[model samples]
Target: MTVEPSVLSAVDAGVATLTLNRPKSINALDHPMVTAMDELLRGWAAERDVNAVVLVGAGERGLCAGGDIVAIHRDASALSGSNAGDDEAAACASALFWADEYRLNADIARYPKPYIAIMDGIVMGGGVGISAHANTRVVTDRTRLAMPEVGIGFVPDVGGTHLLARVPDNLGVYAGLTATHLSGADALALGLADHFVAADDLDAFLRTVGETGPADALAKYAQEPPESAVEGRRDWIRDAFAADTVAEIIERCRAVGTEEADKTAASIAAKSPTALAVTLRSLRDEKPTLAETLQREYRVSLRSLLHPDMAEGIRAQVIDKDRTPSWRHAEHRDVPTAEVDAYFAPLPDDLELTINAAPQEDSSV
Candidate 1:
């Protein structure tokens, strides 16, 4: 019996393409996958003949679902009967998984060659980490993107807050709390994707991009994105999410009194309360560099690993297949200000990532 590499790499015509291959799991990333990707990216970065790199995923379902949360559930569960939180290195596999994962995200942002991500389908969580940071990103009608950590009792990591922070107005804040699923046009309007290529045209672009180069290939096939739903409702999104607290944001969304606005309020209302509070605070950071934001995120991620909600969330959402999760806190308002602050506290023994900030922050994705 032979096993396939989780990540498949190929170089041709001065272009290298890497495909995330776990189609059955929607190419969900695990620690091994992250390591493989890091190695492939480094090797391609040094190869003079590899002019550009394109990232794609196998299977029709999506580019990648996210990290393998079921595995995280396993690790967190093992610590359920022990004291892993007090000592993070012993907490769970999640800490180690994220440590290397965050580094890969930082490197992708700083990659020397043109990094192109073909976000052809569902892109969420870790998927967003890999693709949204790319120099060139392509989205299609099938794309369904989001950073849904709040729902899983986890704060967004993998530099999600940095990317979310740049979305115009308060859309990023709105997205963080509610885990809004973004359409192709929605991603484009929010600056997450560079070009809109029909899902069908993807094959043609893939075949020619290695030789023609992404810019020219995009020029030949890109289309005007479909109208963005989020942009249409930006008036309320900006006004509601600009508030200092989640309670205020919810109230403002209710004040809008539209069907969509009501759903938005309810969506925010249903997420893990603790996750909501911390996620909002992260998004509201005055002005942190991508590296700084990531550093802060690591603190929160390790902090989250110790919390019961992390394991319970996984149990309810993934293991038990129950839609209902009894969160640590009852609601966003119940989450304490002091507790929220602790999620961002400086790590002891300098567990903070040592990556450098991005050269210049671009507000446009």
Candidate 2:
């Protein structure tokens, strides 16, 4: 069956809500959805009737699971065996998608209005790229956030490395390397989420925003609400992820040898060695602002699509439906530091922020 495009956009009561319509795929981002969102966002930015914007998923599970890897598999299959000569062309096409998607991600990072991301379910990888950069990022009890790029033999793109760099006290490295999911309280504590509300209460809260008209009015409506009580195991995360390199991180986890640490270590070990190594080191030193980070990620992402590990990782995880990915480089030491450094190498830096410098006057549109 052919799938329709994933995004549905509408403006109501001065609020523009962009819903991810692919409930069956948990709103996985396909090429069409990416293009649709990019075009729609640019259009909405110029309209005067819109006040605020809310981004959400259509169904009960997630805002977005991630990229449609099955499609990637099909694309890859066409390049194998008798079609080996087509590999370069396929790689270029994949790069184009990365460029467009990363640009869209940068746009969200710099959105002008008081944009809010109502993260209700499993928000991982590319989903974080779209929402984590919003002005007001909200979390519900059901929200699960992670940057699981390494699992797919890809470095964190969609500005994930940039966001992870901004995270405090080495926790970003931990999250990036392990692809561990964070609870609402954990996310808020780590500064990844702004507010935490019960999932059941989310509808009423949004309805109140629709009626209130202004942000101040919405604030007053939510005022005196109970404080968020989501608490996460932060100390362990900080300790486990403190090492400067991927190898060191694994060593630290093994040193602890606790059940949790062992599990974390083993899990990370299962990912692409090159991806984890590069991601850990990159997040440690990546110093781009929101927009700059997205651009940098774009460069690295464009290069990665052609790398053997990315396709192999996707094959194991998504296409074949097997959880075990055989990474090109099985150990952190197997990835040359020089290759890791290349991911951060400067590009022409042609990318521009979609939001520019916030809305000039109230941004109610």
Candidate 3:
């Protein structure tokens, strides 16, 4: 028997359904998966028969855990090594992965048709990149969403800075820094999710949509979520994370003198100091377009790939499973402003993220 592709695509009526198929890995995205998704989406965008698109994962565990970061770690390591030929090969591979991933992210943000993402189970890092930009993001009670890049010594990329920066108040800062997991209800509260359907009802909802189309079928299933865990803490989250810098934010948390505040402070203290500082600055920039934000993120990602801390971060958190990362700086204050600023610097012309014109509308849909 022939093996199926990592990404499975099918069309019923006018709706195109794309499923991430690596169930064993919770459909963690790799280079081929990203490339396949980009190509399929581009094709479907212009196809008159494909009215809308539904994105989902194949397994019960989650939509996606994240990207194939272990592969990236290997490539980055090779790029930093003594072998010139291996370094060139690794550099090319790394460049292709990020550039294409960011382009796909931009495409989803501007997709003309109703793009619905079923955000079931764990959605983090690259998973967020794919689903968060959808026009209609549906989440089930089982959903757990986050952008936990700081823990791995990387700032949030794949246009995460764009979504985090747009959230109200300073909740984005808290989420990015603490790597807090948001429940389904909390996801809706933060405007990260558009609808909530109970986990048990998901299959029925999908069947109805496949049979009758989305707008009406989705309306039938979408229900008001329960009280959000994040909403209950909004007052303190706003107060503690309101400061301009990571250090100040921690100080504010301590001043509150509450257990939750103390926990938040400790969480921030454990992350890579350089990552925390760079992430704070990325969230603060006032970029006007998703493409612009992605371009800036591309710069940050390349810098992080070369920086010493990223490898160490991945080694401790992922490779060795030590959970004890030896970050370059001891504290957030120790990360120099100049070093943080360098991450956002402009890349060479050939390496910049190139976004084409917005996809044309398909009125026939």
TM for every model, in the order presented, reads 0.95, 0.86, 0.95
lDDT digits (tens) for residues 189-300 of candidate 1:
9888899999999999888797688888998889998899999999889989999888889999999999999999999888888888889888888768777777788888
**Tens digit of per-residue lDDT, candidate 2, span 1-365:** 97655788888988888999999988988777888987777777767777788889988998988877676555444443233332353245555566667777777877777678888899987788788888888887788888888888778878888877877767777778888888776677667877776787778778876788536434643322233222333566677677667777788888886787788888888888887876776687648676666656665664455456777888888778788776767677778878777666664424322323332324452
Candidate 1: list runs displaced more than 4 Å: 80-82, 89-91, 356-365
* Candidate 3: stretches off by over 4 Å: 79-90, 361-365
- For model 1, name the residue pairs that clash: none
Better of 2 and 3 by TM-score: 3
Better of 1 and 2 by lDDT: 1
lDDT, candidate 3, equals 0.85
Q: In candidate 2, which residue pairs clash?
A: none
The better-scoring model by TM-score among 1 and 2 is 1
Q: List model 3 lDDT by residue over 76-170, tens digit each.
A: 56554534332253256666788888889999998989899999999999999999999999999999999989998889988888888888867
In model 2, where do residues sit more than 4 Å from their true spots? 1-5, 74-91, 214-233, 345-365
